[model samples]
Target chain A: MPDSFDNVSVSTKANVYFDGKVVSHSLILADGRKKSLGVIFPGEYHFGTADPEVMEITAGACEVVIDGTTETRAVAAGSSFTVAANSGFTIRVTDSPCEYICSFGTP
Target chain B: MPDSFDNVSVSTKANVYFDGKVVSHSLILADGRKKSLGVIFPGEYHFGTADPEVMEITAGACEVVIDGTTETRAVAAGSSFTVAANSGFTIRVTDSPCEYICSFGTP
Candidate 1:
């Protein structure tokens, strides 16, 4: 079993995002840190976030174009990347559905 | 936005199960409800649950064989089914990778 957090609660939202290709679930910890588990489908999508995010790819592969970057990085399962607050990124899901855990840092 | 559980916490275990096709993360609710979010690859898998399980398909499609049942049920996104405690079930992933939230009830 993975690290068990037998001390907290969670909530899930159905059919999130306007494109219907993404869904998110909320994981509330006792310490007040906030994070989300997101499932993204195949296609090119752009996302902007107000909080700095650490996106960990738990499954599938995709190409990410971070804001202000000229090159794209191909990330697969077990890899991760970071994006600054108030910035954005573009993800191209050409191979498979991507499952990720997006953790937001405290400002 | 989906239901936000900003008051609780969760822990995730990476690369769970022996088959390598199924990975599970642990979600600990404030009420002590034990559930898991699982990602299953394309194939047939048989699973046994220690407690009664309500399996909700959050993404993709598959066929499920509830133990002691004669016919299979085709489940897609937003659908769910139940498996009794201490019993087993078989899931056939024919079309795509399946993401599910499995909630286990108290015995």
Candidate 2:
């Protein structure tokens, strides 16, 4: 995975959820693709998606179950999972915060 | 303050402090100036700096006291505080999460 993105636009404010249990910074790539870098504290979280999304684990680990799926898979750093458009997933972090980059509009 | 920054480089990994009580995403401007966008949860935190920094509160509020100082000031959203190079500051968030943009090496 790329360490950083160059020539992008970034928002200063954060997108806080679950009372700051989950926090992320929004950014736009030079090609206009939207992405968010986020941290999920030790807890379970369910997120719905509008566009087709890809969640890439950057640090730590997480167990995820895609909506309508029964199997929960453990995703480690440098791994990723995908969800269909208009779908959702449930993610759980055990002891440490799980960090990820969520890319929206992935095909 | 500016809502967002363009033509920048952003890293995906986060900087977690105080056991995730504070989280930030590092970035660099087009001119190679370093900056970070961060979220501070409801707690007190002390941070030392290697370079002069300007903390711009983008959302929520905080009380801050620079290192070696005795005065604590209430800084609301859209306001800022400066910390000198080789110095530090103490920040406290009472009820809600505080969001900030820290610009490093400021003059």
* Model 1 spans with C-alpha error above 4 angstroms: A1-6, B1-33, B36-51, B54-102
The clash count for each model shown is 9, 0
Error of 2 at B60 (Å): 0.8
Against the true structure, whose TM-score is highest?
Answer: 2
lDDT score of residue B13 within candidate 1: 34
TM-score of chain A of each: 0.87, 0.97
User: What would the DockQ be for model 2?
Assistant: 0.92
Candidate 1 chain B lDDT trough over 10 residues, lowest sum: B1-10
List per-model TM-scores for chain B: 0.87, 0.97
lDDT of 1 by residue, B5-79 (tens): 333345653334533466555665566676666667678988997889998888898899988887899999889
Considering every candidate listed, which one attains the maximal DockQ?
A: 2
Docking class of 1: acceptable
Docking class of 2: high
RMSD versus native structure for model 1: 6.0
